[model samples]
Target: MRPYLFLFLLGIVLFFATCRKKDTTPTPSTPVVPGCTSLLAPANGGFVTTTSVTLSWNAVSTASSYDVYLGTTPSPTTLVGNAVSGTTHTVSIPATPNVTYYWYVVPRNTTGPASGCASGARSFTYIVISMPVSLGYHVVGYFPSYRSLADVPDIKFRMTNVVVYAFYQVNSAGSLLAPGSATAPLAAVATKARSNNAKILLGINDGSGDGKTNFKNMAASPQGRTNFIRDIMNVVRTNQLDGVDMDWEFPTTSDGTDVTFTSLMQELADSLHRDGRYYLSCAITAGKYAGGIRDAIRNELFPIVDFFNIMAYDDFSTTTPYRHHSDYALASLCLNYWINTRGMPAAKAVLGIPAYGRPSGITQSNTVLSYRNILSQGGNAQLDSAIVSAGTFTNYTIYYNGQYTVKRKAKLSKDIAAGVMFWEKWQDATDGQSLLKAACDTVGRSY
Candidate 1:
C-alpha cells in the first residue's frame, strides 16, 4: 500500500511539473497577405477632368489594411492613405488643369511590409471637371467620344452649352456615315441641356477622308447635297438634337472646293433654319498657321453659318521660330485676323482652343498629344502660369494651354467674340486645373 501511494504521488508531481513548464514551441506564423484581384475605377486608362476623384479596389483575403500611393510620378510615392481599413479612398486634388496621376494598392497584413499583397498600379488623367459659371455667353464644349460618356451633371449647369461630337462623318466617297466610335450620349446630353436651359448640338466632321474633295463632290450637284441634308434632318429629329455643327476642315481653301463648301453651308443652314429650333454652326480654319489647319478665313462663310469656331491652337507654324503653340500672342493675332481683318461679326465668332499639345518636333496630326497626356508625362504647370502672364516657358517645347492660358483666352473671347469653344472637353483636365473650368471661372467672374 505504501509503494502504490509513493508511485501515485510521483505521477502527480510529474503532472504538476509538466503543467508549470513554459511551452516554447511557437504557434503558426501569421499568414501572408494574398494577392489582390479585380481592380476597378478610372477604367484602366481612364481620364477625368474634375476637382475630386474616387479610388477603389476589391478586398484582399488576408489584408488587414491597405496603403494607397498617388502622384504625378509613374510610380506614385505620395501616400494618399496608410493602413486604410476599407477598400475605397476619395482624393481631392488641386484644380491644376491637365494633370494625370498614378495610383496603386499595397495591401498588408499585421506582419510587415514584406507581407503586403503585390497589387499592380493604375492611372487616370484629370480632364476638365465643371464649368462653374457662364455669363450668357456661348460656351460651346465639344464632348468627344474617345473617352467615356462624361456624366452631364458635371457641366450642364455651368457650361450650359455642349456639342455631342461627332454624329456623322464624311467618308472618302463623299457620303455621310455614322461616326460609330465618336458619338457620345445623345439622349442624356439632350436631357441635360433641356433641364439646364443649355443648348446641345451634334457635330458632323470630315472623317478619315479627303474632306475637301468630299465637300466639292457633294456640292457639285443637288442630289448628293440633298441626301446629306436629309440624313442630317433625320438624326436631328431622332435624337432631339437642338442644332448641327459642320466641322469641314479647310473648306475655304484657294481651290474651287471653297465654292462648293459655301453652297453646302447654304443648303444646310436653309434646311436646318426651316425648323427654327435647329441652329447651324461651323468649325473653320484659324486666321493663320494653326499647325495643319492653314485654311485662310473667308469673308463669305460668315453670313451662312450662325457662328464660326476657329481652330485656334498649333501656332508653331509661325516663322518667328518661337516654341509656343497656343500662347496669348497667337490667340491675340488670330482674334485680330478673324474679327478685325476678315470683318467677321464679333457676335458670330467662337474662339477655338486646342485641348491637345504638340511636343517639340511633332507637327503631324498623329503627333498630337492630349492635355491629359502631356500632364500625365509631367508637363510643366509652372510654365503654364508664365504663359498666362503673357510670358513663355523655354525649358520645354511642349505646346498646350493650361488653367491660366485658358482663362485668358476666355476673357479675350468675351471681349471680341460672342462665345468660346474648345476642340474638345475630353482633352482638358477633368478637375481643378481644367481649361474649360478656367474659362468658366474667368469669363463670368467680373459679372
Candidate 2:
C-alpha cells in the first residue's frame, strides 16, 4: 500500500471521528428542550372539593410558560386552563361532589412545548369523604350561631356538615319568627360554609319563649302546618340554606299533634324537594314512645326527613344515682330501637353524643351539664371501652367521647348508623386534639 494513500485515508477517518465527537457534545448555550413537567399539589390520587383547584409544578429551566389540561376522563383532552408564566396557577373548573377528574401540565418554550415535555396525567376526586363503600355517612356538627361565627372558618374545614342552632320561635298563627341570637347574618354563614365544601343546616328549637305553647298551637292545626311550611321555605330559599333541621321536641305529646306533625313534615319535604334537593333533619328524644317519636315514626312520617338524629345523650331521668346520662348502653338501646324495632334504615339513623357529661350523683332530673363544664370539673379525658358502647368516659358522671372513642364511633357509624353527630362544636378541644378533628381524621383514615 502506498504510504501517502494510507495516511490520507487515516486522516479522513480521524476527521470523521472528530466530527462525530462534536455532534455528541452539543453547545450548552444552544438551549435544550424543557424537561418533563411534574405535577404538584393534588399529588397522585388526591381529592379536591372546590370549583377552583390550584395546580403547581416545578418550573423547567428553559420553560417560558406552561399549558394545563383537565377533564373527567383519565386522559384529559381539554387544553389551556392557564398560560402560567410561573410555577403555579389556580385553575377554575366546575367541580361536582363525589366526582373525580384528570389533569396534566405541559412545559413550553417560546417556540412551543419543548421536546419530551408532555407530562403524565394524574387523577383526583372532588370529594374527600371516607365513608364506607357500601354506605355513606355524614359527620354533622351543630354550631350555635348565637355564640359567635368566629369558629365558622376553622370548623367548616374540619366538618362535612354544620347546623346553625336556635331558630327559636313558631307563633300560634302559623307564623315563623326570625329565631334569636343570629349574631351574624345567616347569609354570610351559609356562604362561608359552602365555600369550604361543608353543608349548612338551620336548626329550629321549640322549647323557649313563645317557642313552646305558641309552637304547640301552630303545630296543632292544618292551617298552622301549611303557614309554617310556607314560612320555612321562604327562609331556606332566602338564605340559600343547605337544609332545615326540625327540633320539634314533642310533636307527639298531644294525640292530635302527631296528625299535624306528620302532615307538616310530609308537606315540608315535598315542598323542599320541589324546590330542588333540600335536606330536612330532626332533633328528637331517644325514647321511642315517651318522646312521642313512635307515633310520628309509626305514621311513616320520617320518610320526609333525610335522617333522624336521636338525642342519645341526656339519659338523666326523674331519679338518679349518678347514672351515665350519655351511657354507651343507653345509646345502643336507642339505636337498636330505631334500627331494629321501628325498621328505620341504618342510613337514616344518626346517633347523637353529648359534648358534655353530667355531675356524678346529681340527684336532680334534667339538670344539664356541658362538656366544657365537665372538662373544667377536672374530668380526665380518657377513652373507656368497658361500657356497652365504645366511648371515652371520664369521671363517674362524665361519659363523653374522647378522640379514640370518637374515631371508633365514626367507624361504627359506617356500619350501624348513617353517621355520628355532636351536640355542639365549641365544646371539643382545639387543633388536632379536638374531637372534631379526631372525627374528621377517622373518616379520612377509614374511607
TM-score of each: 0.61, 0.61
On a 0 to 100 scale, what is the lDDT of residue 424 in model 1? 75
- The candidate 1 region of ten consecutive residues with least summed lDDT is 385-394
Error of 2 at 286 (Å): 1.0
Q: Residue by residue across 136-248, what tens digits does model 2's lDDT show?
A: 57777776666566744465444755554555457556577774547755776667667766677777766445334666677777777778888888888888887788877
- Evaluate model 1: give its TM-score: 0.61
**Residue 215 shift from truth in candidate 1, angstroms:** 2.2
The model with the greatest TM-score is 2
lDDT of 1 by residue, 253-312 (tens): 456666677777777776676525577788876677443344434567676567777777
In model 2, the Cα lDDT at residue 429 comes to 57
